[model samples]
Target: MNPCFFYLLPSLLLIGFAFQSFGEAYETKPLACVLVEEIGGGGSSIPRTIRQTPVELHLIDPLNLIPEAPITSSPETLHLHVTDPSGKLLSPRLSSCEVTYLLPQEVPLAWVRSLTEEKRSPRALGHPWYSLSVKDDASGNTVSAVLGPQGEEDDKLTVFLAVYSTSATLYARLGDPLYVPCGFWRGQQFRSAIEWRHRALGDGKVLYAYDGRLDRIEEIFPGYEMNFSTLQSQGNASLLVDKVAVSDHGTFLCTIYLPYIRAQRDMQLEVTALPTVTFLPNPLFARPNEEITLSCEASHFHPLEISVELLRRLPGDSQFSVLPGVSLSTHTLNKDGTFSLTASLSIIASPEHHGARYFCRVRHISVPEGVTRSNTLHVAGVAGLSLEDGMYLFAVALALYGSLTFLHRKFKLVIGIHESKKDE
Candidate 1:
């Protein structure tokens, strides 16, 4: 034998063994089919039907998974796992499968299950089902499928998912623009009918409605607006209130309808108005040693709950302290669902209190930092004379004295009785 024959023989054997193993693994890989239902249209309504496509389970690329036809109805237990074209679960149950329900955005829908041979299917509820992912624990292979409503084989099927805003409650300032977000994700191709309704009182009222081609805005709902172009192009069915009012504070329902599917979402809107603050008796004046009441009023705020603090900074104090003997009045309800309140502070006026700064600090949900209105105390003298009055009296007396001195000088000059020429 040649010297190199031994090396060549080992290399050829290793290559043959690798190829045999690859062939065996490929042959054992599971094969399944995904069932998809789609609506056909060609200027006329086409009946809905299911189409089947075969796929190698382990060879699927999870990242670039394409959405198949929409599922028309919620999945039954028998339909929990992927099946072959004949509507049968893949045989030879290769270990347990981990199933995850998902939204259109690929977000897990708060429901997950493990499918064993005995417990392979479980019912899911709560949110409208959109997409599903099934993974084989043993093989680490995943397959995703989109779901919609199911209809009869010969009937048309409508596929829809009601997607609500993540935020359940929205706050808007009074007289400001208010946006109520809502939209829908559909598995099939169809025109959408959108309606925005508000329920604040007895019955719900429609603010805006669109029927594919034409839009109907309620005459009573002025300043309500929507962008039809955006809604058609992007499925953005949000409603815009040009100016939010007390009447606009309520629960808003956005409903989207397709041929055979209808879905809706509701959100709460709360309107907040900043209170108008004022100090009663604008020019605060008090007599020395007299008891006086200083009142601060905060009016036209929403949500009822309010906090009032009467703070006082004495004539020589650097920081204001919470004043004592302060009382808040009961809240008064207004016609438009706003509230008004008065906070009073009673104190004895004295010279020490003169020129002191008094602050009325109002706090509410609308104004987190709080609003403050201040007034300076002007205390009159004990003898019923204000500081300004005393200054006026002093000026008058000085003028009289100057006039008397001038007259006396003139009289002396006139009596100049030349009888005194004393040299000094």
Candidate 2:
């Protein structure tokens, strides 16, 4: 023997021992296995033999088996094992096995390589099939089985992995612009359509639809807009609402349709409208010892639950206190789907109430910190004559006195002229 052969002999033996041990270990216990038998094919009547041993075939990372995409940059090894029906190691190992690639009718099997470990790049349009044929050494029996895309032979498995994510909640303030995001992978040269539906309305109303052209249902969903140019270039099918309303609060469904493929995603929208708080008849004036009613209203708010507090701040106090005898009205629904409420405070006006400030503090889901509107009270005396009214009366009396004095002087002058004329 040559010196080189002697030097490489140990390495070769070690490699062979490692491979044999790996095969034995794989056959002894497989992660999973399925028993399969060959059926008649090619218009021939062939008797099928049920094999006891199960074949274990695994496609690691099946998600990467997308058509037109390279299976991997590097070669991927396929691990196969033969085990008995009881999941025990077989007595005699398989003598030979063949792995075949069954291509679609359009693509010939000769174009792809037939190897246990190879980089496979399938055609863009069709499904590639795999088959394993094994022969037991002891019984001289052969078994062949077709491995998955898990359907009938005639059914095409269109692999679709969503490129976008959903199930997130979005918040929008009332009357503000809102954008609902949805995206998908646009296949090459395929006809596609996008539809947006509101699931909260219970009618599944179509807010927007596009099929090579924009379909605007203006009567049902006004103020909704979409850009087809962006959708085509960026695969973005987001819906834009010019103004979000209370009716828009709910789950929305976006569906994308392609040839033999339909993808859908759901999103939630929460619309909040802050309450509009104001006091009715501000700068109120009341007479002492008289009963008066102060009204504060909160309007155009979303949801039915709200809090309206009537607060009072004495003339000298810095902090406000909740006013007594405050009554709240029932929530009134508006045509626009918002709610309104009125809070009233009744009190007997006295001198002590002069220069007091009353506040209407409103709290709602939209504004947790609350909003307050206040009005100042002006209490008049028992006669109900305010300072401005007394000033007005004094000015009127002064003007009357001046006019009477001028008229009296003119009358005296006229009498003197009449007496002089008579004496002459």
Candidate 3:
């Protein structure tokens, strides 16, 4: 064989081996290239800026997120596997890829999960810079890409993590003030429109709306004056419900539209009702030993946190005493969602109890410091007369009899005298 043939043969064999390995590598996509493409950078003269799609992350109500026990840094696992434009999974050795997470200041660093913890693969670039790196394998494969900007970023790929809708339940008296809050997490006061609607009637009645700029609140529905000045600065555009009425008890919806992103919150408002009290057996009359019951009825009230008490006040007493035998019966639910309660107090008629004022008192949580009272019941003595009154009646009867006899005798005498005169 010629000397040149030997050299040429070895070179050809090496080239064939290299081409075969390269073909095998193409069969399985490289994870690093996928990451680079996703992060708006691909090693090419013409940069391929992937159009960053806005992500809508619906979160639970922050108010309800308070952990019952001490909080610890436990990141939720995300089974993330990058894919190519053709929807093919990259290499399983994504372990060799370097990953960086860019987040807005609104989101906490603790909220992010570290993907490297599993096999000690990906590494983060330390505080303030959420950059993670995956070490290259012995075969020399590595991944390097930045997902989003590091800090103070307002560019595309801005993750929108917010509470889609905050659910809240509030109670107020029929005439008390009501405040419903629209919670916008962090300072995400993007350009948006605020709308408040009453969904209770299923008509979606508009209560208020602030257009493109929150310069002033326009009361779409009359009789509502809402304030939204702090919306731009604090992201809290709360609705102020003044002099809440029973008709206002229902579901309310608050909507914030940022053109690209839309959010909503729901609130259930319950307007508490005050009871109307009526007394049964008004102006009660009974014999000395008769048993009588006085009932206090409280009707048309809400949230059944009600109680009825029977009380008695003496003629000269400054304070009334609660009757021991007073009892409260189960409340009845009315068709209008209001409740009715009845309380009764039993009494054995006596002179002392007679002329005593009795009434039923209704108390409820809605009325913090006030109570409703039924009509006063004035107790009359036996047969509308006491023993003393009967004695007086007897004495008056005797005197009337004596006077009648005297008048009769005088009349007879006068008649006799008149007859004699006539005869003369």
Report how far residue 86 has shifted in candidate 2, in Å: 41
Q: How close is candidate 2 to the true structure, as a TM-score?
A: 0.51
lDDT of 1 by residue, 338-395 (tens): 8899999778888777888888999999999999998877776533666665676789
The best candidate in terms of TM-score:
1
lDDT, candidate 2, equals: 0.61
Cα-lDDT of candidate 3: 0.54
lDDT of each: 0.61, 0.61, 0.54
Candidate 3, which segments miss by more than 4 Å at Cα? 1-76, 79-167, 183-189, 201-204, 213-219, 278-285, 289-293, 304-363, 368-424
> Which pairs clash in the backbone of model 3?
123-132, 123-133, 125-131
For model 2, name the residue pairs that clash: none
Better of 1 and 3 by lDDT: 1
In candidate 1, where is summed lDDT lowest over 10 consecutive residues?
A: 106-115
Superposition error at 410 for model 3 (Å): 36
Residues 1-424, candidate 3, lDDT per residue (tens digit)?
7899987998999988876664443344223321222444446675656432222111111233222222232233221222122111123443433333433222111111111123332122222222223333443332222222223432222223222222356788766777776645322344456678887666567788766443444446755665656765656667887677666778887765542234455668877988888887854656666787777888888876887777778757878887786777888988766789888877776766656677676777677775745333333443366555566568889999999999999999999999999999
lDDT of 2 by residue, 1-424 (tens): 7899989999999998876764554333223333344544545576565543433342222223222223232223333422122121232354354544443222111111121113343343255444444445565443333332434333232223132333256778888998888766544634556677897856567787655422332223678877667777877778888898888889877766543334466678878888888896665777776788889889999867888888889878998898777888898998888889999978777888787888888888899789988877777653366675567568889999999999999999999999999999
TM-score rank order: 1, 2, 3
TM-score of every candidate relative to the true structure: 0.54, 0.51, 0.42
